[model samples]
Target chain A: MGEIKTVIVVERNYLMQAGLEAMLMEIPGLMMVKTFTGDEVSLAGHIRKQQADVLILNPLALKEDPIVFLRKLKQIGKMVVFGLMEKETPVNLQSHFSHVLNVSDSKFDLQNKIRSVLHQDTRPGNHNLLSKREVTILKQVVLGLTNQEIADRLFLSIHTVTTHRKNINRKLGIKTVSGLTVYALMNHLVRMEEMGGATK
Target chain B: MLINKNMKLADVIHHDYTLVPVINRFGIHLGFGNFTIQEVCKEHNISTGFFVIILNAFHDPHYFPKERLQSIRLNILIEYLQKAHTDFLEDKIPEIAFLIEKMPGECLDDRKTYLLIRNFFLEYSTELKNHITKEEERVYPYVLKLEEAFLKGETDADIKKQIQDYPISAYEAEHENVEEKLFDLKNIIIKYLPKPKSDKLCFQILREIFSLEKELNEHARIEDLIIVPKVEAMENALKLKGFGNG
Candidate 1:
């Protein structure tokens, strides 16, 4: 009902934690209630005690088991957990957190992603998610190889590879080869440079 | 003789010997006795200062009065570095140059072949230069300083300052750069070489290049497992001393 205000920072690095706290405190109506430097066990405890509106997490502190920690955080209730990811966030882990922010992103982009997660209606709509295998098939398709060529390369039957391509197209609403290529680049699935002869 | 739980002499000796080849394979030749005491202490997670004392005992035959296992450790490390990295580099560099020279005539177009060859030369040269520079300028100097401080019985503060200023990522970034270039080179060769119009010369060059890439990959692995960890431990010790806390 009211404006979302309280924030709790859970990060391992002392410098980063201090910086984030300072930034959050500067934002009007946003209160950084507590900051803790520890792994998931301590973080879970802090969340329960603090009952803060949002939890800013440094994913590295989850100690090589980010998914398990994410699941644990989800069980703690309605509090939103945003992860500070470096470069690329693992796709499988994307489902658990409310939003992921790349640490290297420009300050403005970061602020926008955070604001969208906190205030806007950018929730990913219902779409049948492509399996990792399907994504691989889609990548190959973007590479401009025919079904038989992909099947031979992957050591799969032509029928199976065709099925995967169909599924990928149906799920992602990518009908044309050009569309698949654009999707691959936009999602950081494959860099434009790596596409090489695929573009032509 | 009561051995401290933290001082498992046999385990230390085993780890020390095992890591010699690994260090050598990485092309790191910082000298023997330079690493044994520091390395063993690191495996056991002891302070760098204490490690220095152990190194001192090992270096002086009359000090700890034990057999000169530390010297043996250093000798093995030197031998390994010589055979694995140094000798391999001597053999591989010439072979790579020969392959690059021979590679051009094989491709369908002279321009494409020249482009590929030039890219390979530039990428490899850049990566190798960066790698050597970092080791020479930052990593090696810090190791030398740490060893010197240990020999001089200098305080932790002095040792810590040297460790703090070491370039830890320079070695890693160079490795990554080489990896990227190797990937591109491999793909280019695979796609363009061995075309139906290809002759025997092209095949030979491609084969040699592949082998050279494999050797470099193995070299990178040794750097990661052996040299990098030692450098990292020294850096951590330095940071703990309130140096480079920023």
Candidate 2:
């Protein structure tokens, strides 16, 4: 890898932030530049000043509108924006971000996603941002619901759920549905316990 | 003499009998009125997490369904408290045991132990503040709304629909904040435990810190499992009554 990338983790959860910090510390080429808890209001100025390479943002911090904050992060320039999408992330809001990571993803997949996004050789490609359908599918995956379960829950055909999963994996460069499940938990999508319901 | 569920903390404080139990348990004397749990915690050394549990018990809001509290039978609460105490002992006892091993050869200073104890309390207090703010401002409100809706006999669909509009994920996110602070405080204790230069004061401070940790851990559990779920139910009830939107 080139020079180690610095990451500023902006998460609302104290425990998750500490855990993420510990996990990130174990990674080879990633350094946690700083970490802040709570919403963008408490963090905007500090993040702007720090100018770290990546800002790991928990979207739940945006009490009013997350898109506005995402846009603001984008405008700051040179900082890669990765959002921890909640389970109920609105459809309209999904389109605005460059890359969306579900909070439910596993530790291994989360590290992989972070590494892939941070170390990608090319200048950030047109971020294959997740669409509304993709997010819903991802949520189902996080819940460990099979294609059949997802189809039933969302009132769609099994085929559609599979297609959504495929699209999601393709866009995110993740290989398996298991990878998606890990992504969902680490990113706080559906929570780990909820997955037991859909895992079968 | 029973206070209504809608009664404010100010209202409860006005009743001498109700106020006595609150003051006795919390060690904070509120002069003649119902005060919010936040106020009570601030007055006492007790954590707001502990106070939240007591508040929910007092005010059976929709999100904070009475059922969750009922589920936490005395035996279960005692078991949990025991486990929490055990965890504290496991974590701190070793350090103290080691300090005791070294105490005879090394001389311990009271100043050093006092400094360490002070730092421990400071760190604990900081974490407690952050944890309380998140619960009061986000998690408690959501739970209260949920409880309110459920109490009104709203269908799951109606509750789901209402929740979809307001969302509970944010409150969960706030839970993560509390977790991080707890971790930070733990690290601080690990880092700052008095270097016992062969002294009894170090042992004394260690014991106090260990006890404090035990109390705080139990407080956190009660808030997370009991108060949080209850508040969610109350919030649901409020939503059902169309009083939660504001």
Candidate 3:
């Protein structure tokens, strides 16, 4: 068995919370840590203490502003949040979660859902792997072109170029020009000779 | 754990030793064997409420009581933020740079890679320095001056001219994302650094980078949560009073 991934369910509906908990137990390597009605005072404080790996929150059940509360929870540390969506939840609140699970998901569906999230969490390449567009932008970046110059060369709008550049930074996790240049060199995205002008 | 005034200073430090540097920033030195938080603050001539709030906010990211912070004087917050900037530039940045500088010597085979990483850090340090300089030289003074005019319910022509030329909202809009580079630097080191002879120095560098990143985030949060909104409110109030040309 792999490491036990603890989970906390915060749903206002007792039946729904119980059902989620029961199904989660059927999945190997997952431990149901706690369940909250979501209106409990200092739920944030309680949840912080529990130190669970995954928090399954029904966004509508949160007494405090869900967006702000979830954001704070995220800032606390690495916890994968799965929104327990029973009905229509606002887009803003839904954005806080990594994935959403329907109230009616069966045990098999639930197992798959948890597995995918856990896999993504533990997977190293899932985060830093650059998309094709990101690689193109990164190439332009290492070539020592300004945003405007890149935009012109690539026939992309300046806004698109900037967004792509930001995404490249986020994907590769290398920020400085030299850092990115080194990454490109290591990955053979560009040769050492290609970066001589920009790196020095 | 939430901090309160009546708790013993020693116990508070025990609760989160990371707060030692935080309290130190407030000029509260160690050696009080049994001073309560309130007593310590009183001795230091610091507002107990403000001290408690700053400690809690630093200890717990979610603990920021926005209303409580907004009520305090902006200059107090600015002064604290300025101290954080000074700490970053003078202590934290140099400490990290020294660690990175040691890397090339420690791993001669990967000297070029280490040097590239060092250069990246140097560039980031320069950017951070410039960002801090802009805040200290321009943004902080403008905010202090704005607060003075707001408190007096009057703005002199000079203050008005400053506002007309560059409003507080303008500063808020162009607040550079100075911390983003640190995120990238951390990722590069952790994920892509060529195999080093020893992981010891890399571990230390990553630790310092993480600490600096956390502190930088908190500093940015203070400005976003407290300074910007208060300044914007004051700007609106001044405008309503016919203080500056829109």
Put the candidates in DockQ order, highest first: 3, 1, 2
Q: Residue B29 in model 2: shift from native, Å? A: 35
Candidate 2, residues A46-98, lDDT tens digits: the string is 46655467888877765546766666666565678887776588866765767
**Model 1 stretches astray by more than 4 angstroms:** A1-200, B1-89, B104-112, B147-159, B166-176, B193-196, B238-246
Comparison by DockQ, 1 against 2, better one: 1
Model 3 chain A: lowest-lDDT 10 consecutive positions: A37-46
In angstroms, give how far residue B239 of model 1 lies from its true place.
5.3
- What's the TM for model 3? 0.71
Consecutive 10-residue window with the lowest summed lDDT within model 3 chain B: B107-116
Model 2's DockQ score: 0.01
- Sorted on TM-score, best first, the list reads 3, 1, 2
Candidate 1 chain B weakest ten by summed lDDT: B60-69
What tens digits encode model 1's per-residue C-alpha lDDT throughout A133-190?
9888888888888999999999999989977876675455444565455456545577
* Cα error of candidate 1 at position A133, Å: 25
Off by over 4 Å in 3: A1-137, A146-170, A186-193, B244-246
Q: How high is the lDDT of residue A48 in model 2?
A: 63
